[model samples]
Target: MNDHDAAGPSPSPEHHPDGVPKFDRRMLESLVCPRTQQVLIYDADAQELISRAAHLAYPIRNGIPVMLVDEAREID
Candidate 1:
């Protein structure tokens, strides 16, 4: 087999290595703000989960979400 066949498709600007999408959308479907218990808006570019009700943005690092008030950033 050729290297191209083994490697499969090259990583796109949007995806990570090993053919895994950065942060699965389906998982976020059930994610909610810990404080307000409200739905969160996923920010793909910023890699954050925004909680409008709480006016906070939770950071997601290495495909894992950091869902902590202390770690969240206050938003306007």
Candidate 2:
């Protein structure tokens, strides 16, 4: 068998080698701000889930979203 067949398919860009499932963009369709129940914008550069309506920036750590209001940082 070929090496490709033995090692299996390569991981997608959204997946990490550490076995953590990267935050799927599709999640934006379902996930909402706890404070305002508004749609969130994914900031790939900052790795944050931005809630414009709530004026808060929720951090994404290790491919997991920390959605708690207490964990979020206030923004302008």
Best lDDT goes to which candidate? 2
TM-score for each prediction? 0.72, 0.72
List model 1 lDDT by residue over 21-76, tens digit each.
58777879889999999999999888899999999999987777889999999998
Instruction: Give each model's whole-structure lDDT.
Output: 0.86, 0.88
lDDT of 2: 0.88
Worst 10 residues of 2 by lDDT: 12-21
**How badly does each model clash, as a count of residue pairs?**
0, 0
Error of 2 at 53 (Å): 0.9
Model 2 agreement with the true structure over 1-76: per-residue lDDT tens digits: 9888999988765665565557888877989999999999999777799999999999988788899999999999
Off by over 4 Å in 2: 1-21
RMSD of 1: 5.8
